[model samples]
Target: MGNILSSHSPSPLSDANPSFHYLVPHTAYKVFINHRGKDTKQSLVSSVYHNLDNRGVKVFLDKMCLRPGQYIPQALICAIRSASVHVVILSPNYAESEWCLDELLLICRTGAPIVPVFWEIRPSDVRMENKNGVYAKAFRKHNKVGKFDSRTLEKWKEALRWVSLLQGFISEGEQGEMVEKITACVARYNEMASRQTI
Candidate 1:
């Protein structure tokens, strides 16, 4: 992960109702985990969600849902609005999905701090610059990557590095350190929000 942007706000736990939209009395950070549904590992998501929840970090995950007919867009937008952090789990299949790109675009537009978790797929699989790149072509063709050129494969690695840095997912050895950094980042934001009330 590159430099993780620090929030100027206080902690979220200081508030009475720390729900995403409540203007949490303290600094409440709602994190939206964006990823390909199929790629979300039970152990990984469950562990992370449990850990964050236990630590009072509000997490938005698709697995925790209502009935099939519920209005997903409204709920998702609301969650995004309430969150201060957005985590994008990047994988080959991630860019293949229109929904993931929409979420990424929305989060990016919102100015929320984004954390990209690089999964099994290499970063090059998601470059946005080249018109024929996987990510670029997908967006251009309305999220389709079937006709991508083979020559661009090498260039995709650069795109992956860019995306990883843009989203703050560091190399393998940095994973544990990154988590600690993120935890502190969230804590700092919550603290800042808390001070606003003082």
Candidate 2:
């Protein structure tokens, strides 16, 4: 189910008391998986993508193979815009890639439904302040690039903070279980899409 954007902020969350919300949407490809290819390609990301495909959910991963020196952002942006909901797989190195961050920033800007699956990390660690946080470092690194506009960078940072606060499923170590949960979440999105078109 999608989280209703309330006027208020949610209370502090702890491991013992977690709130999970999947931002389900109504669109063409019931789901769009936002992931870092290097971080989760051979494992969780691949598994989740295939599982969603097997279930006949149109996925936005077709542009995985781009020719050398291609305009990468165009393809990714088009894909994100066409899709209904986004499934953001946050692996350890997710924030390092400019593409992944750009995709996420767009997804957030559109206000689409999202299912954020955290792998090998806790919800608290995804915040912007943790000194040792990989996300924080990678996010900070992106700002140093001179070409991108300052306003766009600010939106990206805001998106990061907003998405991190949304309730989502986690994979401590059980990849199998995580895949199952993600698959189920996609299924829910599909259901929602079907209803909207009716």
TM-scores, all candidates, are 0.60, 0.76
Model 1 lowest lDDT segment of ten: 5-14
Candidate 1 lDDT over 29-71, as tens digits, reads 3777777777664644455566677788777776774336435
Error (Å) of candidate 1 at residue 63 is 1.7
lDDT (C-alpha, whole model) for all candidates: 0.54, 0.67
RMSD of 2: 10.8
In model 2, which regions exceed 4 Å deviation?
A: 1-28, 62-71, 144-149
Give the winner by TM-score: 2
